[model samples]
Target: MSFLDFLASQFSKLQKATLVESFQDDLDSSVTFEVVDRKIPFLPLFDVRRLEFQRGSSYSYSAIYLNKHLRLQPIYFAVQRLTESFFPKLSSLGSALVLGCAGCSIPRFLALSSKDCKITGVEYSETMIKIAKKYFIDDPIYHYFLLLHDDAFSYVHKTTEQFQLIYVDLFLADNNCPQITSMDFVNSISSLMAGDSIAIFNSLCLSKEDCMKFASRYASSFTATYVFDHQFHYYVVFAKTSSLSTLKAFEKRAMNFVRLDERFIAP
Candidate 1:
């Protein structure tokens, strides 16, 4: 199938699955979620909060947000760790883009971590964007955010602006969007990145073999790549240039994240 066709098919299927149902599938602990807010869409922009029983703290996800602080999920902690570690001085960064914009967590975190950083989220779901603005982002636009709307690919194609940080965390329901695995899409996205930018991808897979296959394709699109695996998921970070120096800077901060995210790192 063509790229747009594939995305449409997956997106249609995801819309059939409610956001609450998707989160339910992801968190299968019989825990109940207290509804915070919701918007009826093809996929309901349902926001709910629950106590992570194991962790003994409340967490939330609505199509996106995973914590009150809107932090990256533990599964995606490395993406944040690497971003933090690589930057050294976070405020030096200028802008960030979050593809998929699930609850706008990355943008939220970036705002807190860097005052100068402007964050733009590209989300296909207008309902999701509305939910985010009302619930998570809650920020006055034209100043902090360019806003989170539009087809991600179209936005990538038209925007002349480049970003220091780009997050590729698109998902439809519980499935990873098929288009994200393509090298063509990766290359198109790379064109919108700054010279020293980093792109992090969240890949969902049924097994390690699947992760490896996708990682190989993504690795070819960047100068250097790092893969972190957990269960059936693989997260990859690709550096556009200064591969060695970039990894070295990231290594200096490795110890900072090793303890917290180590358990999920598959052997």
Candidate 2:
């Protein structure tokens, strides 16, 4: 590696170590983490009794932040990486929907990247939405952002509006992505998408076989499907408009963004 690259790597390692040490000290305390937004203190009230960051293959960091000091570490890194890589296309669409938006990370990223796009996020957890609005959502830049506190399934079944992009990431406690993998859910999502719309499903299942099963089921409803594997049990399922040319265009946009921002790297 070049000298500058090596230096940056070392600095990143140091920062991670420091953060871990601080997290350990605050594990027993009710600590609030804040993100800077125009010098405003937007703190997420989490009793983060436990926090762990694991380094997986492909230079990824998987973080597990527990509420009751539990040591339950779920699949986090791969999903985050995949979302960052595919976010350009997901955000550039005219209208989008994000189901199971915990803390609204993907929605915030989308809003920041494509200010003109309309984003509707459905989240069951009111507390999570509150935290997301405070820390993640930028009201000024994202005038078209709408957050709904409701069940994902109910929202998809009721909403008559069509979307150009749809993202789903549903999981229960202890990293278990329930068998909400029903055909009805797939049909509901498909009916709500536009002609060239795309749907992305994030799963914590590591096996390619399992991921393909999910993709195939989704493909049964949509026009086409593909899976982006980000090692460590994180899989991104893309449905509809599976043209190779379209995918290549999306990848080119993602690569360009990666070149501009070092924090964004695809698996």
> lDDT scores for all predictions?
0.59, 0.52
Candidate 1 TM-score, true structure as reference: 0.67
Q: Write the per-residue lDDT of candidate 1 for residues 122-175, one digit (tens) a residue.
A: 888655555555555665422577665787877877888898888887765555
**RMSD in angstroms, all models?**
12.5, 10.2
**Distance from true location, Cα of 194 in model 1, Å:** 0.9
Clashes of each: 0, 0
